[model samples]
Each structure stands twice: as structure tokens, then as C-alpha cells.
Target: VGSAAVVFQAARLESVPDRVSTLPEVEIQLFRDAVVQVQEEMKEIKERMADVLPAEERALFDAYVMMLESETLIDATIQRIRDGNWAPGALRHTIEENARVFEQMEDPYLRERASDIRDLGERILARLQSSEQRRTGWPQRTILVGEEISATQLAEVPREALAGVVSATGTGSSHVAILARAMGIPTVMGVTDLPVERMEGREVIVDGYQGRIYLQPSERVREEYLRLYEEEQALSASLREHAAEPAVTPDGHAVPVLVNGGLIADLKPSYVEGADGVGLYRTEIPFMIRDRFPAEEEQYQLYRQVLEAFAPRPVTLRTLDVGGDKPLPYFRFEEDNPFLGWRGIRITLDHPEIFLTQIRAMLRASEGLDNLHILLPMVSSLNEVEESCRLIEQAWQELCDEGRRLVYPQVGVMIEVPAAVYLVPALARRVDFLSVGTNDLVQYLLAVDRNNAHVADLYDSFHPAVLQALAQIADGAHHAGKPVSICGELAAVPEAAILLLGLGFDSLSVSVAALPRLKQVIRGFPLERSRALASEVMQSESSAEIRDRLRQALIEQGLGGLIRAGLH
Candidate 1:
């Protein structure tokens, strides 16, 4: 190893401290140089990847490079001066401006530019202030840093090169969390006061799965980590062995397993996993992935190709579910609570033209396919559902009237909000089917932010209230003779799947990685027992009671025993 380097591990320092040199001029110069370097790097990368990526993706790469080099310093500084002092978020706004530009771009590939731009800016900022600079020490190198890191930066760092990750501040979705999960590297975030500088070049063990970091770990700790790593490896090998098997319940009930895809790249994993179909094909992704709105022909071709790729298998295309938490900068939704604001069916009602265009593309794409379905997200009122159905009919009628070939996909609505659930019986009277978005449903029910770690634990899908609401929606849909499905993270967990099956959900959509395990859970599950458990759970008063009772019931049914053994 080279000379020891002091690593600062702590949270992000937004404001310069009194002890640290507040050299504004130096910071600006360094930023400018960094911008230039990023531009050069982007050009080189584009030159290498141009042939591999589509034309639209190529433009996204170019725009990201431009965003970095595009004098954001001047704009941000101007904002700071206007506000009388620099705010912690001023730089973010300047970056957000570029994000807006990318969001408005009409190309699917370019729309992803915003994610790239935001990630790049965050990385640059982290490098400027973060204690961990790029890899510098020799083989078996020792590097130092301060508090937690963003998930994006961790993802960029070489997994094999780094010994561990320590962060001062990070939530689950932060760059650190995402990167750590992808790399399977040991990491600990939210360690408010860990002394990173003291441990430079020293040995330590990072238990990422447990969210623990050990400095100067003793022999015992090291031994445990080695053993744990071996165990994890063995478990992973086991998971891989039966990845392609169909998920079937021990009682002989088979639930179709599918994948949720946002971008074209997500399709590769879905294909490899042998997903029965694309349960939720987010239409906004293509729109958000590009720099501008895709031309009609382009959208048609892409949708056609995706349909062709998964021919005969059902692919439910959700209309642009933007606004609220997932606001598009270019769309300009000025609401204090974007999540509660106009989105999904609301967006379609307000901008029928945008809705018509997408519907037309989907219709054209499904010309020879019969497995396509149209889904509406965040439907709060019966009118929204009716209007959406009318628009679909109108689009199909226009195409047929104009002698244009079109496919009429079955229409569906997402029962996410409480209002949707309450009115689901009425709403189901019009729509052909219903898919419960449990993530939002739980949040909307509990009035909590699922993404906010402080309240994350409170965001329980199994809360009796949430389960009751879901059961009500499922019952209402069934009463109205419509199929009810669950397409959310909750459906991915074995525990939650038991409840969903008991609640009378006809379909449960989950991620590709969780399918095999979920299948295993299903195969061992007894529907009669699950239904009985569900009835007992529904009658329970508190979430704790529900959780404990459900867990105990699983244990009694042999499923909980498997869970205790970590077979799930």
C-alpha cells in the first residue's frame, strides 16, 4: 500500500465549516475544471458506445455532457445572490433546470437524460467534498473518507477495489443503497459519527446486510464475516439453480409470474427470468427516457417491438402516470403535494391529445396481438375511469373510421388511493379489471412517505387498515365481475403473498429476482389456511396483532417454520 491517506467518513457538509477553508474561488475553478474533464470523458465514451446505443440514447449521452459543462455555477450563483445568501438547495435547482430540459425532450432515450444528469451532478459534488476521492493507493490500498455516501457514487466505484462503504447520510433509495444492493458490497449508511479518518489503511469488516461497520475488527468478527459470506454464497447458488422453475403453490394453485419493466434494458432481465408476461409496462418510462416526446411512428415501432417480443403474453400498458411524487420538470405541475395532484387518469382527462397519441400508438402496436391491456393509474373518481374508457373507445373508433388498423386493449384502473378503493365497486362497474398499487395504497392509507426512512417503518402494507381496504377493493371488483390483481412490492414478499391470495387477489405481480422465492412460498401455501388466516387478520384491531397473528399462522402452517429457517 502507498502512504496512508486520511479518509473522512461523515454526512455531507452542505455549508463550509469555520475550520475548513471557504475558498469560493478555488471551488469554482475546481468545478469548472471538473466540468471540462466530464465533457472530454463523455465524448470519449460516446465515441466508443455510439454503435451500441440507439440514436436517441446517443443524444442523451451528449446532453448529459452538455449539462455538466453548461455553466451551472453562474446560474446557481445568480440564484444565491437573488436570495441574499446561498441556500443549500440552490445548486440542485440549477441542476434541475437541465433535468427539465431533458424531461421535455421527445425521445425515450433522451428522457433518461434527467436521471443521468442528476446522477452526474451529485457525483461531482460528492467528489469535491467527500473524503473518498478516486482510487489512489497501491494494491491492497488503504483509502479514507467521512460520513455516508450517495448510492449513485457507490455504484460508480469499483466493487472489487473498495474494501467497504461508510456513509454519514443516506436513505434506502439514496445512491449508496442502490449501488450497494447492485454490487452486493458490504456498506453502512447513516452512521452519523463514525471516525473514518482514523481507520485509514487499517483492517475493518463491513456487514452491509446488517447495516454494521466494524473498525479494527477482532479475529472473531473477521471469522464470522468469512463464514457469513460463505453462507450467503451458498444460498445465492441455491437460488440460481431453480430460477427458471414455475412458481406453483403446494395446493396446486399456479399464479402467473411476471416482471415490471420501465425501460427497454429492463426487458433483458425479464426475458432471462422467463416472466410469464410484462405485468406493468410503465409507458411513462419511454416518454421519460427520451429527450423529447417520441414521434408517433417511433412510439408505435417501439411498442410494436415490445409486444412482438412478448407475443401472446399479456402486457398491461399504464398510461403516463406522471405528476405527484414523479413529476416531470418539463410538464410543470405546480402543486404543493404533487402526489395528490393531477396524475394518471387525471393527466389524460386534462390533456386528451397526449392521451390520444399514446393510446393510438398502443393500439397500432397491438395490431396482431390480443394480449395487450390498458391500465389507468391513481383513479380517485368513477368519472376518471369512465372518461378513460371513453377516450380509448374514441381512439379506436377514430382509427377504425379513418381506415387505420388498431387493436382495442382491455381497460383497467389502479386502486391506489383510499378514494379509489372506496369507489372501486362503482369504478369496477365500468373498467374491465383492477390492479392494486400497494406501495401507494399503504402510503395513502397511513398518510406516510414510503420513501422517507424516518417514517419508512411506519409504511406497513400488512397494517390491518391497509389489508381491509385491499380486501374491500378485491371484493368489490369480484362483485362487479372484474379480475383484481396486485402489482406492487408487497406482492413480492412471501408473507404478503399469503395475505393477497387470502384476500381474493386473482393475480400477484412481482420483480424478476423475487419470483422463484415467491413461487416457493406459493407452492407450500395452503389456500384454505391462508383464507382462514386472512379472515382472522381482518378482524384484528392493530397492525401488531395482525403481523403477529399472521406470522404465527404461517408458522403453524409450516410456512413460518421455513421462514424461521431462512428458506424464504
Candidate 2:
């Protein structure tokens, strides 16, 4: 929770009139100089961001560099400008045309990349105008408000002066939200109804924990929130005190709490503390950041960094789980229902060259560490698993032939598809473990696109059907003498973590921001109590009932603060 004066950022480029204009030789030279200046500025930002942001985030600036260095963009803009077109207008048109292609795409991640293009265009436009275009009059405590907050905009603010952030359109997974979480700043996103024009200079409270904002709250409400804010601070301090503590139940049931990370920032002392190991090390980030496929050596180095950082602690590296929301720019495909098609294992299996290269790199990275665990995403049938195993074996044998001593890593399948849930026993027989990707499982099971705001309300991890699937997955994995774990958004919630523990998940892999709170819940709540709660939750007829049961359980345990205020 945080309160500050709202500063609504205006869309300056949009306000500028668009027109084609004849440019003199000097004007053309000015535009050329502007391009060079923007390129230098982008390089400086990229260098500065390398130290402050995670490797994955710093890669975002690479797109800007690519745009600035692109012969197509520069040549086209210069031609248009020399042909009696405004430089800013030409650049804006080119950017919009490119962005429109992505904007028309179904994937939210690609759609969000459109914003990055627009942001870069704005930066170049400001440079062309010979203006810094930097906002300077920030309040001591400023809550940056905007229709859509950009990573560059957030980075421009003085971290000390910035208190919170509110965007009218964005999800929790958006780039701005990721940066906010990294900076420990409170942020509320996807506030579609926020009156951005009226928010400026207003005193607002941002309840980021609950994804809420209170504009000009009453005295009583203000006082109550102030109290909540203090409690939240205390909770954070208390969580830190137990950072190194194990997430074992009071009744002696141990639950390993791991983090789901893919960036270099996850290797930081702050993020690594109190975690068991990486539950889901997304291998897609490195691939997504580059213009071309990463070389086997590049992949090996990146994977090795994560392996070495968490040496001896099992790091489950999921092989390229791209498609759906994440699409590689260099490699593109079209699908009617991309989520249900050409994604995850399907994509890799079709392109054995890609699969083999990645597997070899992973094997090489784990040559000595032996903590690497390979996970297959979106496995539906037994044949898929068999084929994947065959490929893995091929990579291992090839590496061994090269005289490199290697230990075969344990393999697992992500139970995201509904078919995988029923095939758990067969899968367990082949793989070493099972992991429930609750986010996608819920999406596929309920036939609701969680990214679609119109139908997002129907997506609930606590639904009776979802809970039943979790139970079945756990039971099937256990029957085959294999462990099952959840590495999704559901695993991060304290109340949900209790349910997962009760439902027989062996471990909970969550984001770094959620690790401490989950550890606290696991350490405080007894396993027996969690199991009992799970039993009661299974009997619930609806998601609402299940949520209420979870919330009441936390309140009864004197851990109500862990519950979001919106739930209350």
C-alpha cells in the first residue's frame, strides 16, 4: 500500500499534429543527426540498464537498438523525409505499420511489444524536435499514472521520488509491472476505468497488493489504510527475519519452496535467499531476446550461469516453451488457435534441429553440476514423451561421444494440458516427476482464455474442476512413486499454497516476490490442517465457496494479513 500525488503522463507524440512537409538540406541533416543521437542514447540506456535490470529485461533495449540500426527503418524514414515528408511523421508511420502487425496478433506478449515500438518512436521524435521531452516536476512522493506505462517512462523517474504506479491498461505480467516488482514499487494495472485526465495532483492510495486504487478517500478510510500500510510494512520485516528458514509445517511436514525464474536477477542474493532452487527456469527468455536463434555455446553459457549459481540445488530447466503468448520474432508462424496449436513440445518436436541443439547445450551445461532437470512442456500423448526421451537420449549420446563425461538429467512433463492430467501415471512411469502449470491447466480445462479481459473473470484456479484435477495429478504421480509440484501463479498465493500442500503437492515454486510470504504460510500452517482444509475445499460446489473457505482458514489462523484486502 502506498499514497502519493498522482502525475498522469500525457501522450505527447499523439498530441503532435501529423503532416508531410518539405525538408531543406539542413533539415534533412538535422534528422540524420537526430537518428545518430537516438542511437547513442539507446546504447547508453542499454549499458546503464545492464547493471540495474535483469538480463532478460535489459534485452528489451536490444529491440530499440535493432530499430535504430535497422537499414530498412533508417533508409525508409530518410527517403520519406527527403520526399517532402515530416521526419517524426515518417518515423511514426513506420512504427505504427510495424506495430499494427503485432497488435493484430492474438498473443498478449506480442501485442505488448507494440507499445515498445511506439515508445521508441516517441523517443526518436523528441530527439528530432531537438527537445529532451523529459518530465522534471515530480512531487516528493509521486504515483506515476498513465493510460499505459512504458518501461522507459518508469526508468526515467527518480526511484527515490517514485512511490507507486497505476496504468489504465496492462496485466500483472506486463513489462511495466515486472519492472515495478523488481524495484519494490507498488503498482496497480489494468484499471480500464481510471480517469487519467482527472487524476493529476489528486491524493490517491495505491493498494497494489489487492490491485486497487482509492482516489480522495474519506478520513476513516484513510486512517484504516494507514493502519493496513503499517501492518504490511511489519509483515515484510517479519518475513525478512525468517528468510533463511525452511518452509516446514509445524507438524514436521517439509515443503520445499522454490522460485520460478529465468533472468540473471533471480540469481541475486535477495532473490536466492530462502529458496530451495528454481522450479521452472524458463529457457525461452534468452531465445526471445535475440534476433536469431542463440548458438549452442551461448545457450550453454546462459544455462551454466543459472546452474552454477544454484549448484547442488536442482534447477528444473524447461526446454523452449514458446508460442502462445511468447513468440520469437525471428521464427514466426500463424495458427487459428495458437494456444492449442504449435506451442511448447509440439514446436520443438517438429524441429528436432532446434530441440537437439538446446538439449545438447543443457547437457553440456550440466556436465559437472548434475543439478539440471529437463522438463517437457505441453505433453499430451505417451508418444510425445517417448519421442522427447528419444531426442534427449540422442543429445546425451552425442555429447558422450565427444569425450565429455555427462550424467543424464532427470526428465519431467508439465501437466498443463487436460490430456496430460489423465496420463499422469503413464507419464510418471517415463519421467522422474510431474509439475502442474495451474495457469494453463485452468485455462485449458475451463476453455477460457485467461488473457482475454472479457472472459478473464471465468478463469479461476480454485474452481472445483481445477481442484479435482490437481488431486488426480497428485494421486497419479504418488501412485507411480513420483513427486508432483505446482509452479504457477496459484502456487504463489498463501491461501492457495495451503490448498496445494493439502492437495499433496510436494513443492511450491513461485516468483521471488512471493517466496517469503509462501514460506511464512508453510512454516506457520500445519500439514494436517492444510489437508483438512483441502478436504473441505473439495466438497465445495463453487469457486466462490472455495475462496471463502481459504480466506476463513487464513483468518482463523491469525494470518488474515496474508489475504488480499479485495478478498476481505
Candidate 3:
């Protein structure tokens, strides 16, 4: 839950004009001038973002730049207007055509790009309208409401005045949501039922924690949220006081908390303030942002910066986890079931050259500071692990052959597939450690695609079977005398972190935003009590019961603030 807010700032675009017959020459010139003005404004925004935003976020503007620089866009617009079509209609057609291609894509990441196209198209269309048509002035404690809030739209709001954000489109993974989190603003996305047109200047309460919006809230409701808002502030301040403290239970069990990062921005003081280390550095992020594969030198520099930031603190880097939900724009492929198809180790192992280059860069980057830990993603068989190990060794040997001193990094396999759960004993015997990627593990175990909204409700990490699997994996890894850790969304939850602690996870790797609350939860809950709770939940037959039990546990401990509103 984040700070609750009153007053809505509706950010709607001007209505598009209807298509008309050939415009006068003056109208055409006006249209051209508007296009140039919007393009220049976009350029200025990009330049300003260079110093403030991360590389991945700055890349969000690349699509806008591409659209503005497209000769086809201008040429097509001019030709269409000359041939008896309206400028706004012509631009909308082009944007819709481009967006439709991505909208039809199965990958969630690529599909979200369609929103980017629409966002840019709206910006240009807004410029086409008269200045008087646009709304100005933001209210105090503004809850920015829109059909689809863009990164630039979010950027335009004053930080102090912006309390929350709500959108009718996009998911938590959208760029706007990502920026909101980075800025510590509460956000709710994909609110299909939100009455965007009527939300202007309305007194609304945004329950970001629960993804609920209150339209002209009752006085009782407003008072109660006001209480929550004050309590949240006090709790946040208290949590920050202990940010640098170790996550040790009152019963004396110490659990190291690490941050899962992908971008260079993850190295910011805010993110790393309380982080023990970088638990899972998504190497695919660098690859995903680029048009082509990043060279070895480029990879080396990036990895080295992360290594140097938390030197001596272990940083586990997952090697190229692409081809499924995350596909490279440059390296395209078609699959009936991409998630179940050749992804993760399958792709890297198939192309040893890509795998080897990455490994070599990782090894070389860890030259003096030996804090690098290599993690292999989506491993189901013994052969994949063995082959991957061979490639790592080959890379090490090649680097050493060049007379460069390096440390042979510890290797681990991500137990994401059901096959890997049963094979944990064999897998643990081979690798230095095991990391449970609960996100994919739960998806594969429950036979539910977490990304698909239709079945998303059924994707429960607390399912009885999933809990049992976690217990089994932990037992198997411990039996083999190997350390195990969890680095997934499950690890980020305070309740789940408590269960993971009981399940024998050596460390909990969560997002930077989740670190403080997780630490507070860990420090408040006793290890023995957590173990008993885990055992009790494992025996429970339903996920609802498990959640109730967990929620009750939080309330009993006076950590009820961590619970989402309405759950209490």
C-alpha cells in the first residue's frame, strides 16, 4: 500500500477531427508546423531524460523518435491530405496499423509496445489541436487518471503534487508503472472500468495497494483512508530507520536480503541502500533494449559496473533468459508455445557462441573482485546443466589463456520447471547453489500462464502443491549440502518471505521497493513461529486458507500495516 490521495487529475487527449476533403494549402502548412513542434518537444524531452532516467527507460523514447524521423510518416500524411484525407485521420491510421501488428503478438512485452505507439500518436494529435483545448494546472494531491498514462505524461506532473496514478490500459510491467515505482508513487494499471472522462476534478481515493478506486468516497471511507495514510507515513519512516540493518529474526536467525536488478538505475543509492547484494541481475535487459546483440566489451563494462558497485557482496547474474515472454527484436522466432518452447538455457545452449561470449565477459568482469555468481535459467535436464558448465569452463580457460587472472564463478541452476523440482537432488550435486524462481515454478506447476488475465486469478503461489514443491526443493538441496535461495515475486512478499525463511532458504532476493517492508517483517517475526506457520500452511488444502492464515499471522504480530487494505 502507498500514500492514499484525494482529487483526480484527468489527463485526456483532444478528440480527433473527422476526415475531410482536400485541405487548403494554409491548413496543410499548419499541420506541418504542428508536426515539427511536437517533434521538437519530443526531442527536448529525450534530451532532458538523458541525465535523469536509466538507459532502459531512455530507450522508451526511441519509438517516438523513430516515428518522428520516419520519412514515410510525413510523406504519407502529406499525400493523404492532398488526396482528400484529414491529417489527424491519416496519422491515426498509420499509428493503428503499426500498433495492430504488435497488439496481435503473443508476447506481453512486445504487445505493450503498441501502447507506446498510441501514446506518441496522442502527443502529436494533441499538438494538432488549439492550445486552449488542452487542460492545464494540477491539483494538490493529484491522482493522475487517464486511459493509458504514458511515461512522458507521468513525468510532466510535479513530484510533490502527484500522489498516485490510475490507468485504463497497460499492466504493472508497463513503462509508466515502472517509472511510478521508481519515483515511489503508488499506481494502479489496467483498470478497464474506470470512468476516465468523468473523473476530472473529482474527489477520488486511489487504493493502490488493492488496485481499487473510490469515486466521490463517503466521509467514513475518507476518514479511514486518512488514518491509513498517516499510519503508512509513520511506518515508512520507521522502516527507513532500519534500512541498513540485517534481516534477523527475534529468535536470532539471520536472513540476508538481496535486491533483484536489471538496469543500471538499480545501482542508485535508494535501491542499494539496504540491499545486501545483487541477487539476480537480469542480463537479458541489456540485450532486450538494443536492436542487436551487445558485444563482449559492452557486456563486460556493464557487468563490471554492477560488480564494482557492491564489491565483495555477491552478485548472481542470470545468463540470457530470452526467447519466451522476452524475445529480442533482432532475433525473431515463431513458436506455437513460446513459453514451453526453446527459451532460457535452450536458446543459449543451442547457440554456444552467444552463451560462450556472455560467459567470457562475466568471467573477465570478475577479474579482481570475485563476487560474481552465474545462474542458469530454465534448466530441466541434467544434460543442459552439464553442457552449460562445460561452456563456462571453456570460457574461463580461454580468458586465462590470454593471461588474464579470473575467479571461476560459482554456478547455480534456476528450478523453474516441474521437472527440475523432482531433479533438485541431482541438479544440486552439480551446481554450487540452487535458486528457486517461484514465478515460473508456480506457473509451470499450476499449469497457468500468469501473464494471461483470464487465468491470472488462478495463478496462486500459495497453492498447496506449490508449497509442497517448495518444501521438496529445499529438502533436496539441503540434503545435497547445497545452499538454496528464492529470487522471484514470491520472495518480495512479506508473508511469502516468512514462509521462505521457514522453508530453509538461505537468502531472500526481492525488488528494491520491497526491501524495507520485507526487512521489517523479517525482523519482527520470529524464526520458530515462521517455521510452524509454514508447516501449518503446507498441510492446508487450499490457497485461500493459506492466505488467511498468513494474514492472521501478520495481524497477530502488529505488522498489519503490511497487509493490503480490505484484507484486514
Candidate 4:
């Protein structure tokens, strides 16, 4: 394979400039004809791919085709213009403005979609102007560099056959990275702007563990990589031995290890790791992927599959936390700061039908399951909790009236909001459990935007304010005789795990990949020692000071390496 590493400072937008700057009468007529042609071609293509691709992939392709339908865009634009949503000459301007905002967003998914909008806008103008069509070709043996790839083109490459992916964008937690891991493909995205196309037909190597991409490696480099790969394989194989064992401390205290997952497909790894349960089930995925809300039957089918996949293992199914940063294209909403906008439980509450429908589906699907728990996200007030419970009750009554046997899952409220933390004593009394959503809790408490890379360092879970909130919530839950869990990324941190155990968390849920290291952390320190360390940590003035103190304590206890590797 050919490989090169020339940094792309900025993407060179290629299109026929001024092609649609002035639209004529003849051009508008041609645009309408083009729309008809594109629609016909799309219909024929879908029919041909019916048997070749899976239903999900087929649906994705259809959605892509729908996006390119000139009639749909024209109609949508016309409707908006008629409704006076945009002033005269603002349609293209609106799309361009939003596109730039998306480009600047930290999330790779949004950033890539921003570029997609730009492409879409041009196509709309082309349809309006009757511009000459451009031919598209394949980039075989070429490592395509972009922030993200089209969802329709996601499965184009055979998993093992593909060399590697080096995206100009993508976070470790993004869907693209998750898919790459599942496919067992070596991927190192977020590589600034490496010239991916030049790597075509060039011999190269990808080291995902070290996030490195070697271009035209010499014999020595190849040999070293082979040796390291073998070593890694051996190390991974060794982990299977402990897969069946309960994760316990040296003194024999059992710490339940669970996996965080969204799809039922993740259940295989959860079972293989001997996971106690699913810590977090992102229930918003199905809704976000679809063009519109799924039918009640369709929702039940998917939920039923997940309930059956884990069987007896507890699955904490969080309600749809859509809107804000994660807006569904099907639903239109405007907001200044999406992060602080209407989201999570608020969306569900406002749209009671949506909430009731999902609850009914989950309840019906969980007919024989005792481990299903419904978790509410972004809850801040007691009223929201009360209303959510009322909705659950209403759904239960409806299910009963219909003579459908259903098991109403336990309701848990995430204590992420500052107000929720303050009222945990009262909220704990109403809910079955309390799960501290530290990712948001820390972000909200410090008023720091987690997505802002420039201020990411300030977003620390170990902050004194964050710890104090955690302590309060956990203590309140304990007092109320309800279980408390930390489903946030902080629970995965080695040092943070010690504090969590000390602060009275019933369970510490983390990413599946972090389990082994967390297990090591558990074995290295006693519960009592961790409690003492926690007490000292809580008294520290600043998060930095607390981190330093924790490091010193870990080093004193001969766990510097573990802390450094997993925590820092």
C-alpha cells in the first residue's frame, strides 16, 4: 500500500463556482426534470439491493437517497419560506451558517454531518440552477481521510480486509470508533490531517494501541510490529482465564463488574466478561437511527430482544435523552446552546405520548424479566420525577386494561443536575435507585462545557464540589435504603473507583474494557484504606490538590503504576 503524511490545514471545497449564482427560467424547469430523474434512479436502486443487503443497511441507503431527492428539499425549503421561518434570501444563508457551526463543534459526528449539509446545500442549488452533474468514482486501495464516512457507505469494506482508518475527526467514544473496535479493525482516528488518499497501494502499519500510523515502514519496523502484535494477542488471550471469575479484592470483597452498552449486540461481550449486568443501556439509539419514531410493536421487539439477551442480568434502560446536542433530523428544534436546551427527561415529559409509548413497550417486553430498570436522565426537580412515575403508572394501567402481562421496571433518576443532587434525599425516597451521572454532574457543577477541548482539563470528576455532591447523593440514597450506582466514566478511573467504593456506592459501573484494570485496582487496596483516602480527598481545597494527594497516597500504598496507567 502507498502511504503519505501530508497535513491538510483545511479542506479544499471542490465545486463549480458561480454555477448557480444566478438562476434563470430555463434552469428552474431543468431542475424539476432532474429531480424526477434522480427519484426514479433511487427507486430502481432500492429494488435491486433488496435481496443483497440487510434490512438495516437497506433502510440506511434509502435514507441517503431521500436526502438527495430534489423534490423533498425544494418542498421543505418552500414550506419554510411560506411559513416565514426564514426571511427572503435566507434559505441558503441559514444552511451555510449552521454548517459552519457544525464544522466547529468538538463532536466528530456533528462536524462530519456539517460537511454533509454543505454538500447537500450545493446539490439543492444545483437542482435549482440545472448545473452539470459531476461523476463519482471509487477510491480502492485508498485510505479515505474525512471526519466521518456516510452511514450508507459504512459497511463497504470487509472488516478484516481493510488496512486501517485515520479520520481527521472522531473521539474514542464515538460510534465510528465503537464500530471499528467491534469489527476488530485497527483504527487511529483524530489524527489531525494526514493525507489518507496518498496511502493507497502503499505498505503501511497502524498501531491503534499507541495511536500511530507508519508510512512505508522498513523491515526492522515490520519485524518489531509483528513481535508487539503477538505479545498483545497473548496478553488478550490471558484475560479469558479471569473472565469466569468474580471480580473481588485480595481480602475477598466482591465488586460487581458490569458493561455499558446501547445495543443488544453488546450482550455477547457482557456475558463473556461475566458482567454482573448492563450499567447503562442508551435507549435513544433506536429512535435517533430511525427517520421517525418506531411503531409500538417495533419498539417492543427491540426492547424484548435486549431483555432476552441478558436474561437474568440487570439492565438499566435509560429513557430517550434526545434533543440538545443529539437532535434527530426528523425533529426540528432551535436552541442557542443545545447542551443547556430541552433534553433528556424534559423531552419525554413534554411529549407524554412518546414517554408512555416507550414505557409500555419496555414493560410489555420485560414480562418475565426481574432485572430491568428504567433510568431517567437530566432530571433536576421533584416534579419531573413525580410526573415520570405517574406516566409509568399510567402505562402500567393501560397494559393491564389491555390484558397484556407486563413487568413494570424499577424507576431510577440520574443525579446529574445540581438541583437533583440537592434534592437527592427527597428524590431517593421516590425512586428505586440513584445513579450519579458524574460526566454531566462534574460538567454542570463546574459550568464547564465537556465538549470544549480548550477547557477539557477543567472538567474533572475529582473536583471537591463534584466529590461533595457524590457524597451527598450516595449518603441520601443509603439513608433512603435505595441502591446507588455511578454509571459515569469516572467510575472507570482507578483512583476514582477507590473513592466511589469508600463513598458508599452500591455498585461501580464502567466500560467493559476498563474492568480488568479496575479489578487490579480493587485487589491492590483494602476498602478501609480507600475510605481513609476518600476522607482526606474530600477535604482538599482544589481538584488539582486532591489529585496530587491521591497520587501520593496511591504511591505510598505501592499502587503508583496502577493509578498512573488507569487513573491518570
Highest lDDT model number: 2
Compose the digit string of candidate 4's lDDT tens values, residues 1-568: 2232211211222211111213343444454554555556657767899989878766754654666654445555444444443211223544566578878999997788776666555544444333442212333433433444422233445333454556655543334554454444556666655554344345667776566777788899888877766655564455545656777766667877776666555666535356778778878777866789988899889888877777788888899887654667698699888778889998889999999999988888888776789999999899999999999999999888999776667899998889998898899889899888787778789987664534645767788888988999888899899999998878877778888888878787766666665666777778887788888788888888887776677677677655432322
Model 3 misplaced stretches (Cα beyond 4 Å): 1-190, 194-206, 214-227, 565-568
Better of 1 and 4 by TM-score: 4
Could you give me the TM-score of model 3 versus the true structure? Answer: 0.73
What's the lDDT for candidate 3? Answer: 0.79
User: Number of clashing pairs, model 1?
Assistant: 40
User: What is candidate 4's local distance difference test score?
Assistant: 0.67
List the lowest-lDDT window of 10 residues for candidate 4.
9-18
- Candidate 3 structure quality by residue, lDDT tens digits, 1-568: 1222212122223323334544445446756777777778877898999999998887767667777778766776676677775566566666677788889999999999888777877776676655322334667788877765655457567777888887776655444564576566777777766666556567877776776778788889999998888777877787888888988899998889998878786798766779899888889878977889999999999999999988889999999998766778799999998889989999999999999999999998999999999999999999999999999999999999999998889999999999999999999999999999987888899887654544656778889999999999999999999999998778867778888888888888877777888899998999999988888888889899998898889889987777653344
Per-residue lDDT for 57-105 in model 1, tens only?
7886676676665556445734443554222233445666767888998
Q: Give me the runs in candidate 2 sitting further than 4 Å from their true place.
A: 1-187, 194-205, 214-227, 565-568
Task: Single out the weakest 10-residue window by summed lDDT for candidate 2.
Answer: 1-10
TM-score of each: 0.68, 0.73, 0.73, 0.69
Best-performing candidate as measured by TM-score = 2
Ranking by lDDT: 2, 3, 4, 1
Expressed as tens digits, the lDDT of each residue in 311-370 for candidate 2 is 899999999988886778799999988888899999999999999999999999998899
- Better lDDT candidate (1, 3): 3
